[model samples]
Target: MASTLRFSVTFLTLLFSLWVVEVHTSRKLISIKEEEDQTISHLLKDGEFDDPSLYMFFRINDLKYDLKSGSKLPIFFNKDDPQKLPPLITRQEADLIPFTTSKLDFLLSHFSISKDSPQGKAMKETLERCNYKPMEGQLKFCGTSLESMLDLVKETIGSNADLKVMTTKVTVPTQNTVSYALHNYTFVEAPKELFGVKMLGCHRMPYPYAVYYCHGHKSGSRVFEVNLVSDNGRQRVVGPAVCHMDTSMWNTDHVAFKVLKIEPGTAPVCHFFPLDNIVWLTK
Candidate 1:
């Protein structure tokens, strides 16, 4: 009977040890995940530019819409080869799989992402945003392929119109956020043109394949080639800035209002485009 009692105690002790190890392991994993998230947050800091709040006093002009919202979309730039962008996939290839929550299981399986994984959650959010309706005077479309995006741009601006594509050029290699000043602004396509610079802002979405959330803002928007220099004078990036003249349709609580110290619909809101974003200007 004493031997039996000893065996029971031994079993209980073994189970307790296992439970303690499991808890410790779980906590360690959580800590590692939190640290990773914080790192990404630093990389994706607001406005995609350094010290965006200072934009109000720096180089304020007829530039258009603010892209400095708190969206975790993506912060990384294209692999320095903006010209050789993701190729055009077939229409059937893009249409075969839908980006919808109802097909979450299928979509996750197609992308080889576990439903409970962080990537799966990101894909879900992208799907939801794509499905949402466009804002007032806003033209929104999700292009699964580069061809589709270009086609939409030509349709909106005009098939016969000449075009110029501009992307944010990042010179720094480190992951740290660096401050930059707008040295000067040059209009690639002015708002006063006949087509009024039919601008299309295409932002890259997180996906197995290249997906872009392309939207064209209404008139009263201007596209500019902004010359930026880092505060340390170590990095220089010639990026595109879009300014929205019509803020009446913008949300009252947009970050631009707070940064500029003005209410929405009162003044123009303009922000520098991120590294991966594409700004299409029609000539």
Candidate 2:
């Protein structure tokens, strides 16, 4: 009977130790997973991660993390200084980052205005008049998406009495020689209605060829850049021109174009030509 009691006590102690070990392991795994998620969230908030760039960056870094099974967690070490780990950007802080000309320029510089063109003239005029404040109030009729802006523009122009606007579809070739058809708007009597509006000029750039123009208005000259490609390549940038409105308001126009390129390795490299020296947005 004494022997049996000893065995029972020993068995109980061993089971308790094993249980404690399992609990410790589980907690450690949970902590590591939380850290991994925080890291990814921070990078995304800082605009460091996106479609093509994110994929390439991850592959190049050889980052390995298993989100499933909760066994392994991805660790993010600072690329510049491996010893320091940065805190993630909070939701409130992320909201403070204005999605303005500066942000857009950093993401993509191919679709921008040249200082010499009429469109550039308009952009400069508007920027000066508004003192570079972002668009707000009743003048805040701009759309965030190209499709939404185009629809709004079509409706606005269609209701206008002085302007005769016609929306047409056109096919343009990108630098990679791929073709795409997109909606283009032509405003007849635009000069009479929009006195300062004019086709300033057009130019091209490598990887993505584009033409920009300035449309005059009471607020300022609205810059428009059209993309001339449709190959659906990896680095496709499709959006409208960025506009500076009077009263320190900045808005973008839907008159932007989409760029597509041919498949890689199949076509010869194409060089893009720069437009005449034009004013550029400053830091």
Candidate 3:
């Protein structure tokens, strides 16, 4: 009887120790997340983007963040705009209509585009980029449709994941093109750390229809959600920003370096995703 009682006590002690260790780990993760949040908040508030091109980026309507629970974020342009969004097709459809060199002439004719035109060049470039091999530590895929984009996201973060999609939302119309100097902005929602969050960033590619180039990094990067009120209370933006922790692989003459006045790898480079870009995160 005494031996059994002792064994029970020992088992209870081991379980208690495990529980304590789990609690400690949880607290540590929370602390790290808090620290990351503070860091991102500081960068958003203090980082300078004096160049008009850089400053006006926040005004772009397509890059706004949408955190609201929904079935999924649509790939269309802002409803306020008159031009209707291009029809979104599926991967199978895209493959059949394949935008390839062999069909370049056919594509241009169908889209009413000239081979020598800028849009034509962009289309060709997009095709090339989509086919190009991804760099080390990067996973890339060009999504020709909403379903295709979601497929990539699911592949990256798992199909059962609780997913969140963010795009830039424009709050002020006139202020969209205005400079940052003319604005006084505040963070509507404090920056949140996305540690251990799986992410897929989708960049809108120029096409007759919607084409998204989605990519994810392996490491040395962080993502955050930011809300900004700019243009002296006129322009407000809810957006997602990514901070690249390692810029060592980046070109020395990268624009971020010129704007931030820091060389590659010297410091972390963070920038707001362009209007029309999407950042998918798993909750």
Number of the predicted model whose lDDT against the real structure is largest: 3
Q: Tell me which of candidates 2 and 3 scores higher on lDDT.
A: 3
CA deviation > 4 Å runs, candidate 3? 1-53, 56-85, 101-106, 172-184, 188-190, 251-254
- Which residue pairs show collisions in model 1? 63-243, 64-242, 64-243, 64-244, 65-243, 65-244
Q: What is the per-residue lDDT of model 3 for residues 39-86, given as tens digits with 9 covering 90 to 100?
A: 222221223433333432222122243423111111111221213435
Judge candidate 2 against the unseen true structure and give its global Cα lDDT, from 0 to 1. Answer: 0.25
Q: Which of the predicted structures, 2 or 3, would earn the higher TM-score when compared with the native?
A: 3
For residues 22-47, write the lDDT of model 1, one tens digit per residue.
11101010001223333223222344
- List RMSD in Å for every model shown: 20.7, 27.7, 16.8
Query: In model 1, how large is the Cα lDDT of residue 84?
Result: 37
Instruction: Write down the lDDT of every candidate, Cα atoms only.
Output: 0.56, 0.25, 0.58
Can you rank all candidates by lDDT, best first?
3, 1, 2
Off by over 4 Å in 2: 1-218, 225-240, 245-283
Model 2 alpha-carbon miss at residue 42, Å:
21
TM-score of 3: 0.63
Summarize candidate 2's per-residue lDDT along 1-283 as a digit string, tens digits.
6755664465455334322311110101111223353433322232222221121111111112232322211211111121121222333443443334444333233336565656555444433432343233322132222233323443533322222212112223344321211111111111111234321111111111111221223334333332322223212222222233332222222111101122322222211112121111100
Give the lDDT of residue 272 in candidate 3: 70
Error of 2 at 265 (Å): 42
